[model samples]
Target: MNRAWRTVFIALLTAGVVGSAAWLVFVSPVLGVREVRVVGNLDVSAGQIRQATGVADGKPLATVDAAEIEDRVARIRRIESVRVSRGWPGTLMIEVVERTPVAVLPVGGTFALVDRHGVVIEIKGVVPPALPVLRLDRPGPGDPATAAALAVVGALPEELSSRVAEVHAPSAETVSLRLRDGRSVVWGGSDRAADKARVLVTLLKRPADTYDVSSPDVVTVK
Candidate 1:
């Protein structure tokens, strides 16, 4: 064949290939979604996540808008973050990071569950046994006192947290903890939290009226 004809033939072949690929990715039913999968959910149910995504079976996976789906999923208060993606061949995948509750706040006879970021996750009529109650004069996401209490709550070891009944943050610099057994702990500010937690844990072994680990290096018991 002549060089000109050969070049034309190659161009037509490339165009056909690109067109076919575009059709498969953008318009074909072969890549359509048959299933929607959810991962990383704890407090929220998988069914709720699927509903939030607004992704239906038989929809084109390539056409699903990940950012829009994420926005929808994020509307659920318990979800901290969400990632939406298309699973090749026949699935739509949604991964979620649920907010971890650090403390609960009593509001008008209901309990508000809040994460370490001080964002309220949910409100329940009854307090959950696992989380400690947070005592702040004014509790809100932007409150400095709530943030300080959250820092201290988040820093506490699991062993200590399990024994805690309430967290008090009168001011940003003044934080304290009340244990389930009626013992009081003066935790002070959020600084040196790990050291303070360790000191408090050790001091809890001995019976005392008040345990002050605010200055971990110079702990006091009253």
Candidate 2:
């Protein structure tokens, strides 16, 4: 073939290949989503995640927006975070991390399970045995007393936290813990929590009715 003719033929072949690939990826049903796979979710169901994605089956995979799907799924209050990814051929993958309750708060009639940030994760008819009761005038993300109580609880070691029955925070500066036993802990505030936790661990070894580690440097026991 002539040189100019060969060049034209090659150019046409390339264009045809690109166009066919684009059609298969963006328009043809061959590469469309057939299933939505949800993972890393326990409280939220796969059906709920799929519905939140708003992606219809048989829609071209390449045309799906992962960021938009993530934003939609994150709107579910129980979900702490969500990630969306496209699986090859015909699948959409959604991974979600649900909020975990750190404490329970008494509302009007029911108990609210709240996370470390004091955001209510769920409502329960009765308090769970594993979580401590948080005593505060108002329990919410915006409440300072709630914030202080959660901060103190979050700082406690797992072993120590399991013994805790209630967290009382009348104000931001006054936080205390009531152990499952009659023992009480004066936690003071959210500040120096790590130091207070370390100090309290040592103080608990001594038999005392009340342990004050609010000032970690100068602990008081009675």
Candidate 3:
């Protein structure tokens, strides 16, 4: 064949191959999703995650929108974050990160478990023994008292936090903690949290009714 005819034939063949591959990947059901796998979820069930994704079985995997799925799953209150990815052949993988409750607040008959940002993670009939109780007028993300109380709780080391029974914050500047053993701690505010935590750790060595590490530079025990 002549050079021009041969070149034209090669171009047509390449276009045909590209068109077929596009059909198989984007339109054909050969790569359809058959299962949705959820992982890294503790409070949320796999079924719940799958339902939130809104991806029907046998849907074309390549056509699925990962950002849309993530936005839908994020609407679930307890979920901190969610990631959606395709598992090649016929699977959708959903990874979830759930919020950890730092304290519980009494809300009428039930109790609300809140995270460090004062976002309510869950509601329970009874308080969990491991979590400290928050003493505030209104416990929510917008409430300053709730924010202060949760901030103090978040700053505490795990060992100290385990001994804390209650966190009180009437205002943003007056945060305190009541230990399980009945001792009090004047935490003041969220500023210099690392310094205050260190000083408080050392002050607990001495016997005292109240430990004031509000001013970590000048700590006091009474």
Which structure among the candidates has the greatest TM-score?
Answer: 3
Residue-by-residue lDDT tens digits, candidate 1, 72-189: 9999999999998877988888999999888899999999888989888889899999999999998988888888999998898899999999999999889999999999999999
Which residue segments of model 2 deviate by more than 4 Å? none
TM-score of 1: 0.92
Better of 1 and 3 by TM-score: 3
Q: Ranking under lDDT, best-scoring first?
A: 2, 1, 3
Q: What TM-score against the true fold does each predicted structure earn?
A: 0.92, 0.92, 0.93
Question: Which scores higher on TM-score, 2 or 3?
Answer: 3
For residues 50-85, write the lDDT of model 3, one tens digit per residue.
899998888889999999999999999989988999
Query: Model 2 compared with the native: what TM-score?
Result: 0.92
lDDT of 2 by residue, 70-151 (tens): 9999999899998888899999999999999999999989999998888888899998998999999876789999999998
Give the winner by lDDT: 2
Better of 1 and 2 by lDDT: 2
Candidate 2 displacement at residue 66 in angstroms: 0.9
Error of model 2, residue 170, in angstroms: 2.2
Superposed on all Cα atoms, the candidates' RMSDs to the truth, in angstroms, are: 1.7, 1.6, 1.6
Q: Which ten residues in a row are the worst by lDDT in model 3?
A: 137-146
